[model samples]
Target chain A: MEYQDPEDFIRDDSFLLYCSGKAPEATARWEQWLADNPGRRQDVMQARELVLYIQAELTDVAAASATFRQRLSPVSDLPAPVFPLWKKMLGVAAGLLLLAGSFGIWRYISTPDWLEVSTPLGAVKKVALPDGTQMWLNGGTTVKYIRKFRQSRQVVLEEGEVFFNVVHRADVPFEVRLPGGLQVQDIGTAFSVKSRQQISDELLLVQEGKVLLKKNEQHIQTLEKNEGISIEKGTMKTTAVKASPVSTSGWLTGTVALDNRSFSELGIALENTFQKRVIINGEQLKNRSITITFSRQDNLQQLLETLKLVYQITYEISGEQVIIK
Target chain B: MNNLSPEMDVLWERIRHDDAGAVVILYEKHYTDLLTYGIQLSKDLDYSKDLINDIFLHLWEKRRQLKPVANTRAYLFACLRRKFYQQTGNKTQVQYLEDELLQSISAQSIPSQEEMLIAIQHTTEIRQRVQQALSKLTGRQQQLIRMRYYDQLNYEQMEAATGIAVKTIYNTIYNAMKVLSAELKGVPVITLLLFYFEKR
Candidate 1:
């Protein structure tokens, strides 16, 4: 076989392949090419030397060691992360509760010296009065009085929820007096008072213990445990309250239970627990009722998905806003 | 009778037989030397280790199918060089992660601080120019370069990972390399390649 130009061999990828010992057929072709051009053997030798020179520096041990360690370390007896998924969820829940409690306290501090003391939606307030009696104001709930609790612990309920841990002084009866002549007289066990306000009329429910209610200087009724009363058109009627716990004070438990409530009302409920404004875009969804029990520990996606199913409503969520259609 | 180097012949034989022992043996013999030389070329130890590791790991994994090596050391070194260039390219995500992890803990303790800082500043300058140069390439070429050098993807393996054709992989890599060679002249490929090699 005649010698091919070493330059031609160098230019061919097969030549590079043969020099690198990559191609099988190229070996026979390289021998023929080497015989054809004995003068070029030194170039092949030099190329081979260059190839070896480069390869001598390449190492795999570090990567192999790293991979081996990475795959093994998880099963090793090292201390696992303290803040696991559940703990993170608990932390979030606790944060929400503390925020609700703080907002409750804030509302009390900001209450003006007037006939009414009420908090906006999602505000929980602790009213520490000059007289030592305490009022835990629930969100969107109001309390008004004509002349303060001078005659008797007298205050009218307008809207939302309140838990009164009243300081019982047998002489001064702590009374959470309500509109339409409805009044709840506490014999001093810690109890919550709730009244939902509307365009007209209100709904009131007692969560725990007992309270004596009255209207227009006439004895009306006494509510005892899981009992509720509705007041409309100057008439207060007692009704059997659903035996469910109120989320108003459930912050301590890290969960908020919402019984059957309209989407509008649920918006208020979420706003209180989440400590953010939850605006429902559609008037049509206002009356759509839903029952959803959620933990502040729950992810936002899960909460939204559950609401989507409960109301048969589709929603678009971005950050905190959930637009329901 | 064989003109090939003894180490190359042994590696080829061991690799052909699926011997993990040979992989380890090969790595142990070459690792430090390659690492040292790679470090010299880029003045960055991490970069050198990274590039060197990639070449060996590739050889280890694909040993059974690898083409015969006349000079395994040179082939490995060439692979390292290509890997180093790839790593040092502008598309490296490794630098940020490495910096983030090491900056707090080892940046102070590590011996290569001044060298690393100089390399980083130099790299940052080259990276801006390379990004501009790389912008001239087609999307396919850019993607191919990213996968091959940046992701350390080989031809057949890249096919498996991306479900793309094997033939297309070579074409992609070739076109990308050609464009890079042309447009990125005078830019430091060795440092970038070394940087790419060191990434996790």
Candidate 2:
């Protein structure tokens, strides 16, 4: 009957719900109120307009079906019916069941045998590649290589880290490509390439193999097993000393063994492994570093506890956002 | 004449001969509208298109020896609905079997505008959405509107189909009209997008 303040009417959930639910009499009443209160009708009209816009957007159906049908081959003349002995003997009922069953089986077992294994976010997989090369797929890692090793072993790494235990094939050198134009060629031996998008280039740890760390033609460093090297854009240098294989590749075995690694470096490794958003709130947490055997599979609580025990640092977890203080 | 009527007759003839012309005709006529309808539910055009393609390909492959149909369109609509649910990762064929086990239900009733829309739209996307919005209402609402507007089906027939009091049907349709009127406001003639669905 009487007009209410259109602004107040628009804000009322019942009125909004009635409009949203698309009741006509209520809409008429709402419109009547808006007309009566022309002073604030514009605001009320805007709300009504938004709902109207969405409703008027009826989905297109014919175009979608045409698009889908176009994907199939054009229907031509049908093949003449062939009378198979089995079909005649089995009858339509039996033949249909057998045909359906065989099709189902074929679909299930047809996944390619090429071992293209991918570790879930915050998970690592230890796999033996085709050429007897052992690979420790770090968390959020992906490696694609044919099941059968052919001439010049090739693999493409999309993201995350991996440690390659390349089988010594001197004729077929194993090459690992990092994010930047950095390449590590294994003549024969074991080495680990740890790279992240934000990190400069890839950090190389030669555990057993002799790796020629090359950055765009210039040989940055020739690292022996047990030696460590960091390669960035046009620059590469040997670390202060070599790292032990157990500590370097310990992430494969669910333990992150850190030997004098910085807090930032350790945090980056943990973030990659955990696939969780971590925010370092304090400068002290960024700079603080201590040796600790943190479990890769451990929850944030356990990892934080380990960090607290090692460096007396505390942390907070809020939904997906983790704050290391 | 529209491409639909002629192609429909040809498709039926082809289907009688165990050919997959019906599958091709159905695809040619309705692919876009179905995609548009699927997109509203999926929010991803590429995924919806892929799912629709898979459904049609499967239908073509299985067309031969399918049950002799009194109404080919109805069977295809039901199959499309089943496929939609399957692609959405919701119901399974086992669920349909279970539904069959739960007693053959639904009273012998006359159809509504919603059902009419559904039957027509399965071949296209625009009609499907229009039909879907109508189907959300009680069957009585749809019947009243269709009787008064489309076929002019008498009140008694409408009542028979809807299984509702005739007076309630009148109120239901009246309310539905008002709702549609409000929603349809300010939509420009060019922006109607009637042919938009098939472009997918």
Candidate 3:
């Protein structure tokens, strides 16, 4: 680390690294080298200054926080953002709908506390939440929320899967509770939550924004756009998904794109979509990774044919069960 | 630059890791170029300034999801261009989006105001000599020098930036520095450099 020439000091990348606040060890070494050889101070600083000459200039070079000071409040001073009064408007709209006899009088009286929305097999339905979130329920999925959204925006994903294009609010969290103590809270984005009896707490896929995932009310993970977490049995893994953008809008478009998923997982997806028992027979193939895109309009037999053509796998359909080998 | 600093990737990594200081460096590093390009496209100084700010704001907001980008200039230019497009808001036609109009954005741009400021600052006698020395350096030398001295890129990163060899970068910068040093003749180069800016 001894340097005689000023050019030698300049030639050393560590010198500039120290100059730009990079590589702390280099800074320490430069500090030591300067202390040991006090005479090199002018040369080192001069070389460093030569590099600074070419530094780009800015109209405003304030610190990052100061630059944004006039526009966005500092994180500490940021009061919770209050959204438009959509919920109150929704209550009025619902009352009008009630007067128009959209709801059966008996049904409205019985479950005035909880409103429910569900989709049958091979069906995709969109429900507008009281808070202005556009929720789309996939086949065989059920979601329930408080009828009027009193305390906070929360939904219970009791069965199957659901996607939400949330109207983001700063303080009022939009949470989806699932079985096995799994919950997903939207962090200003469109996301999905899934829960199944077999898989327990199944999946949390973020389409656009971000979501915080928790298990049994404890914070587990935060997922961002095109990021997802899959839970099987009791194990969970967060992943930065490389699936195509087509997959982000898959369920609603009736085009399901599964990337690097196991055979059994594919079977579970098939069961959810078709409402049939999808059994993967081989232990070797059960965990084999598969990536495919298929339309929901395709029958079970047609999908099996696709699997046969692309993956070279055969399947046997017996009554309501389709077993892949 | 032949005097390569070689640290843009590392800088970008720090920005991705929520290093506010790193992002500030990135902002200061590219802000002028971005504004120049923005103004060329939009033809509005205030709008261009807003677009530059918006680019950095989006960068900070989406830092966590950023993919690894090798070319910082291309990346920022693309972001700035995107912001310009968004500001124009559905052009009456595909005017700027066309490659010719796109090229016009840069082709029409002259030496940035910063370069003009550098020129004005070189009016003093000693600085005029430095400027003379600077002018004598080849175009490649000036570019490599700027990337190295200003951008703080190392030899390898400079190689990545210019597709020139590290040894070549070293030699080009070495030759350029020799010219500057000869002109200064025993003056600490930093003193002249500091004095040159101090006049501002």
Least lDDT summed over 10 consecutive residues: which range in candidate 2 chain A? Answer: A102-111
Please state the error at residue A321 of candidate 1 in Å: 2.5
Give me the displacement of residue B85 in model 1, in angstroms: 86
Ranking 1 against 3 by lDDT, winner: 3
Model with the higher lDDT, candidate 2 or 3: 3
In model 2, state the lDDT of residue A44: 56
lDDT of 1 by residue, A66-88 (tens): 44332222212122323356334
Residue ranges of candidate 1 with Cα displaced over 4 Å: A1-120, A141-151, A198-201, A230-238, A245-248, A251-254, A281-284, B1-200
TM-score of chain A of 1: 0.55
Cα-based lDDT for every prediction: 0.52, 0.52, 0.60
Report the alpha-carbon TM-score of model 1 versus the true structure: 0.37
Candidate 3 docking: what grade? incorrect
- Top-down DockQ ranking: 3, 2, 1
Predictions' DockQ, in order: 0.04, 0.06, 0.08
Tell me the interface RMSD of every candidate, in Å.
20.5, 20.3, 15.5
Predict model 3's lDDT versus the native: 0.60
Candidate 2 per-residue C-alpha lDDT over A7-107 given as tens digits, one digit per residue, 9 for 90 to 100: 23333433543333222234445557657776754445444433222222322344444433433322222233335442233233333433455321011
